[model samples]
Target: MTERFYDQLSKDFEEMVSWRRYLHQNPELSFQESNTAKFIADKLRSFGINVKEQVGGNGVIGVIEGNHPGKTIAFRADFDALPIHDEKNVKYKSSVDGVMHACGHDGHTSALLAVAKVLNNHRNQLKGKVVLLFQHAEEKPPGGAKFMIEEGALDGVDFIFGGHLATDLPVGKIATRPGPVMASVDAFKITLQGIGGHGARPHQTIDTVAIGSRLVTHLQEIVSRRVDPVEPAVVTVGSFHAGNAFNIIADSAILEGTVRAMNSNVRQQIESEIRAILDGMKVADRIEYSLEYIHGYPVLVNHKEEALLIEKLVKETISLDAFVEKDIVLGAEDFAYYLEERPGAYFHVGAHNEQAETQFPHHHPRFDFDEKALLQLSRIFLQLANHYLVTD
Candidate 1:
């Protein structure tokens, strides 16, 4: 049965590419996926799946039931594109200005659509039901996953599954592990206010740029010297803005960055250390400073049992050799929100093909993936839904 399904998926692979390319050409930003949502909803409806739109802000849900009653499982795909301009000169490059599907959300969305089409064709042979979640705003904070959960996307779900397209991994491969697949994602901002004066003066000005530069280095020490050596943590200041004139000592400097930690304890410690650093700066420099730390997403821990189930499915679909055990990544995902409520595991599906030059990192304007990877994900979704829902 699986073999036949794979063959059928192969037959429809080009159509799936067309769907993905259309989405890529018309990418939408986070929380603004109105057209993207409509496209997905329309596709699911055409497949005869019961469609539910406006799920947690532009999220779309497709419910397909088997001939008989059984358990219910879900598969999620985030459809929001990043705020990057399309850099690729391909035939289907993004038409939207300053927005493109650089993170393979297009692939994920299309693959889920393909899964819906294939499963709907085999609905009579299915044992239970599958819920398809087309999520929005994955690239932004307060992710669509939380909104979907709030709107009851997991109300009666038994087992849920999700996966990402990894351009670093070669096509025909998948990676998963049992615990701590991704780190906790957080954001922090430190605004340093000081006295402004002539840059030429030695002691008349506070020199906020100097203070901010020192602060950036001091911030990293928390991750390196304070956090556990064995634990994975990152504190990076990706943005810094200070003054209008190079000759004037800027009175205010703003530092914004992200924090990644492997666990809650590590995350807490980093936060505490950062506050301590901010306090020290306030006292020593005698400057007014404020800290805004927002916790974004939790560590993505894969339930051991669910991880094992995914491993089994991967081994069955491809070979054991294609099922690689990957190390924990510092990258965080909002899918952690869904796992908090139900048993689920997120896997990395390889989409890189060196021969085809689909090897750029995600969020890069030049980012793309081998379309065949979409079919692989579709098969995984189809198999997982059947096995998870069908009772013995």
Candidate 2:
């Protein structure tokens, strides 16, 4: 029976990695996860499973009905943590100073609470419903999966599953790819304005730090000479201010960053070439510009028949060389708003372990992983909810 439910999830996989390192030593941020959503709705109501609690704010949902009457799957996990600061001294570190699950999301919420205790102990050999969701503010900024899909959490979800914890993939390995895989975070801010002077009077004014350093090299030539170099854009300016008295010559000069893309017509032609390079910067002849663009999360595209049914249910429940495919990440995911409202697939679980820990990389303030990949993500979410309730 699925190898006795993966041998009782490998005997409680060390109490699910000590409840994912005590939720990575108590981290919480983004919509401030009320005690990580009451410790994941009291472990999904102690696996009797059917808890719901604060739909959008703290976000937790756990259902699990089955006993014939097929299809309705979902298994998300993201409790949110990361204002990053626990420099990993590990013994369940981070007693909250600057919050830090550093993004294994405490091993993806203890691997969906060990797949909600093996789908509530095989809910009578399963045939239908399974929803677990538990998301909170996935690293902030209009996310928590768009407020749990505006408080419905995919109303009657058909198929959905998620996983991510890869210090660049390695510990037993698992990745998937089918379409855009991940990218499409947009954010911009530019100020510019000019009319300050006296830095030794370079012709008396208009400088805005040389028009924000020539608009950050003209916004890195809009992803190198205007997008399409096989379409995979990025235009990071990561922040720039103006002058604050080095003899003064400032009058405003902001310019923030981020702009990644993996199609969406190269993310709308890099936001229309960053508004025509700040409306063609005209410093000396009356400078004045302002521009702001915010659009986060929208690329994680995976659905090619749910990535070939999660690669044949991860090669029949684990290790067909750990089902590899991956590579298409500019990195941005709100789970791309649940694959823009259903038709899911977002995989990758490999919490790298280069000779027993020292991998750190997701939002790093010393990230950590290898909690034995949470018993292979709770046996691939109980074999994708019993293979989509017996083949959809």
Candidate 3:
């Protein structure tokens, strides 16, 4: 039965790829995916699926009900693109200036659309319900997943599944693990205020630049010496700004950076250390410092049972050799928000094209993926939905 459905998907693969290319050409950013939302809604509605528009500021949900009663399963796909220029010279390169789907979100969106179409046609064979989530603004801060959740995207969802396109993995392979698949991404900003004076008079002013430099070095030690070596943690001081003129001492210094950790214990440890460093500096330098920490997204931890089920399904549908139990990724994903609210797993589907130099890592101006993976992704979504609906 699964093979027959996949065969049907194969027949529609070309059309699916065409749709993906069209989306790639006209990309939109984060929460501002108005046209993209409309396109997705229109496609879902055309399949006779119940469509809900603007659920969470440009997010669209398509619900497909089956003939029999069973558990509800959801398949999610992010719809927002990045702010990048398409340098890849392809026939259907990004037409939108300063915006491109370099992260393969276009392919993700197309795969979900194809799954919706296939499931819509096989609605009678399905046992329960399939919720198709087309999320927006995954690239920006605060995340579209949080917005969708605020609007009740997972109100009654049983099991949710999502996948990212990975250039590191070879084509025809899938990689995933049971726990802590991705890290929690948080950003910090610190402003140190000190007395400004002439550079020649060193004792008259509190040197904020000197204090800021010390803080950056101290922050790096939080990961290396404070946090456990087994647990992955990173503190990157990406930006620093101070001083106006070479001869004048600046009144204030600004420091900005990001923190990534796999577990909450390590994350909180780093946060506490940062506060200690800032607090101590206030007393030592007689300077007032303000630290702002903006928590982005939580760590993506997959449920072991759900992950095992997905692994079994993939081994059955595709070659067992194609699945790999990979390690945790240092990168973060907004899909973590959904996994926190429900039992789910997020995996990676290979989209690499070895022959083309355009097959670079995501967020690159020339990054592109093979369109052939769309059909495989579509098959996986369809199989996951059907398998979960019937089994659960």
The candidate that wins on TM-score is 3
lDDT pick, better of 2 and 3: 3
Screening candidate 3 with a backbone cut-off below 3 angstroms (N, C-alpha, C), the clashing residue pairs are: 30-137
Model 1 lDDT per residue over 1-392, tens place: 66656777889899999999999999999999999999999999998899999999999999989887887889999999998998897999999899999999999999999988888887887777889999999989889999999999998899888989999899988888998899999999889999999878949878789899999999989978999899999999999999998688899999999999988999999999999988998889887898999999999999999898888988976788889897899998999999888988999999998655598898898998898899878888877876765444
lDDT of 3 by residue, 1-392 (tens): 57767877898899899889999989999888999999999999998999999988999999999888888898999999998988888888899899999899999999999989988888887888999999998999898989899999898889899988787777888888899989999999999999888999979999899888888889999988988898999999999999999989888999999999999888888899999988988898798999899998888899998888778877887879988887887789999998888898888888887767536888999988877778767877877876766433
* C-alpha-based local distance difference test score of model 3: 0.88
- The stretch of ten residues in a row with the least summed lDDT in candidate 1 is 383-392
Q: C-alpha displacement of 106 in model 1, angstroms?
A: 0.7
Displacement of the residue 155 alpha carbon in candidate 3, Å = 2.1
Per-residue CA lDDT of model 2 for 1-392, tens digit only, reads: 67767887888888888888888888888898898899889987877788888887888888888888888888898977878678876678989788888778889888789878876787788888888898988776778888878989889888787988787788777788888888988888888788897889868788888768877898898888987688888898888888777898998888789898988888988888888767766634468887888988878788888877877888776658888898888988888788878887888878777654548678888878777877777777777776677433
Worst 10 residues of 3 by lDDT: 383-392
Error of 3 at 2 (Å): 0.9
> Candidate 1 — what's its lDDT?
0.89
Error of 1 at 154 (Å): 0.5
Give candidate 3 regions above 4 Å deviation. Answer: 390-392
